[model samples]
Target: MDTQQDWDIYDVTIVGGGPAGMYAAFYSGMRAMRTKIIEAKRELGGFMRTYPEKIVWDVGGVGPVRCERLIEILEKQARTFDPAIVFGQAVAGMNRREDGVFELTSTTGERHYTRTVILCAGRGMTQVQKLDIHGANRYELANLHYTITDLSRFAGKRVLISGGGDSAVDWANELEKLAKEVIVVHRRSEFTAHERPVAQMRTFAKVLTPYRISGLYGSADRIARVALTHTETGEPEEVEADEVIVSHGYDRDFGNLVNWGLEREDYGVSVDAKMRTNLPGIFGAGDFITYGSKVRLIAGAFNDAVLAVNSAKMFLEPSATDMAGVSSHNERFFEKNKAVIEEEKQRQQN
Candidate 1:
């Protein structure tokens, strides 16, 4: 619990409370590191909060787990290590000291000192791109949404989604079973998403591409029609709809972290095989700091946590070598925390 005006030192200070950050915190605890996780949200699980009803399909060693269940499991795993958790605190700035420690200053003027820093912010700090169309602002609050969290509300309703990426296709597929009619419009001719979800969506929904959403036609209570444009001929058309979902990716605001001498490429922060950034004591993992190998999946980010934690351990103890041997240590750590893990599993089942 770090309040403003007092500087509390920790072994590692992890930014963001997504899957990557949560896993990093768990590993930090396993290594017996005094860690603190700083999250902007009131609770843990970043985008997991965005898909409460969606099923998580890619988590390895796990069945198609519910998003809420995954969140509970990850939260429990993160806490099993007993790391000091800080929520609703956004990092305004950060700097690496000459002594190799990282100093983080939050928007609330809270300052944290730690031997290492791991950023797992993901795309949470970014702004969700929207279809800048006529009458967009009116429905922006009432009928328009940037992300999908729960699908129950969409059942028996007509939904129009804009975008051709994995998100748009995934949502289209998910809503197909629930919603009355699902329509997906993409600016690009070809979908950039994986073939599986794309195929699934095409089986049920109307998939149109190389078209842009031009305007919103609706009354005060709900959205009724969506104006669209053909990319090739500039032809315009309108489709009736109940709700419009825009998912064209996002733009990030790294904030003053850009001034902290952090090593980041256009993709994200750069880190080595061990998740060690260019700065010795400053490390990054997950979507925020992957160098060349960027896997946006939660499972991939969890692997990044393994590397980052190992690197943090070696950095704290310079005499350490062969961090590969830390795997047994990790197993022991998980074993010690098995009771909590079992509790979460039961909760998930119940």
Candidate 2:
């Protein structure tokens, strides 16, 4: 494992742990650059972690992969480079020093210095909205959850999903197959989710509209039922439930990056074709960056990562190769995995 003392300065410091950041770490390793990824969340995957059960069909080279599975594969690919990964830390501030190195400080007081910085901090800081019921906090440790990590946990249980957004409806649809009974409670009469999924969810799950969870009722350790009130009629009803999922969406902001002196759009930072920000020695990628005709897809973010990493590499060392060649044909691949490659080669020869 590479430690702070192992290198005087990192070749690249990636500011996010999403798909773009993870791929950048891998590519940086391919380029033999010392790399570190700092993520604000306790785990990697960024927004993907929120809806781990969601099926992803847009990512390249994979068909109908789950969000959690994609993240697992991406994380494994990133680990090949052994990049130093720091979780639960948010970049609080950053500055370029006279020595031509960038210094970064995290909210936790951790400091990192790197030759070049890659801004992959997608949507800056993000947080899931929580259930606002009076006693919801008491059951949070037990049956109440803001995010679903495992679908099996809901098996045979009665699940109550709150909210009308895409994630809420999606989870309701997914949990309907695992749970004994699934009920979707929304404050508004109409759902805000995409029409197709919402229509599909209605076919499997009981949809309760124009109603809000008025009160949570149960033991201190777990939730047993909830009281719902009609949004307009103010009529009350009770529903038996084993678990409640709050998917009110997220409260995401650009956070400290808004004040970082970089050119900004209403969405995020602005970058050029090379993924270079207005600041030298700094680049941006993924959902955190804005450009003309940006696709805002995982594949597009990956392209951004490649451009950013290559630009940063050349910026740091003008003599460095403009881009790392194909991994299958690159000498660095064999050099780094000599034992495994040799073993595979011998197995093939036999």
Highest lDDT among the candidates is held by which one? 2
RMSD of 2: 3.3
Q: Write the per-residue lDDT of candidate 2 for residues 1-350, one digit (tens) a residue.
A: 22456375899999999998999998888888899999998888877887787789999899999899999999998889799999998997988777777889898988888999999998668877777665578888898989888889999998999999888987887876789989999999999999998999998898888999988888878889889999999999999999898888888866676788999887778999999999999998899999996768889889999999999889978998889898889887776678778899999999
Q: Model 1 TM-score? A: 0.81
Cα shift from native, residue 31, model 2 (Å):
1.8
Winner by TM-score: 2
> Across residues 1-350, which tens digit of lDDT does each residue of candidate 1 receive?
33323246788999999999999998887777889999987899887786676788899988999999999999998997688888888887877666666678898898888878888888746567767765576777777888766677788988999988888888888887799999999998999999988988889998777899887777884688888999998999889988888889877676766666767787887788888877777777788876666788898899999888888888888776534445445565566667768989999999
lDDT of each: 0.82, 0.87
Poorest lDDT segment (10 consecutive residues) of candidate 1:
1-10
Q: Which 10 successive residues of model 2 have the least lDDT summed?
A: 1-10
Q: TM per model?
A: 0.81, 0.90
The list of candidate 1 runs beyond 4 A from truth reads: 1-7, 98-100, 134-142, 231-234, 291-296, 319-350
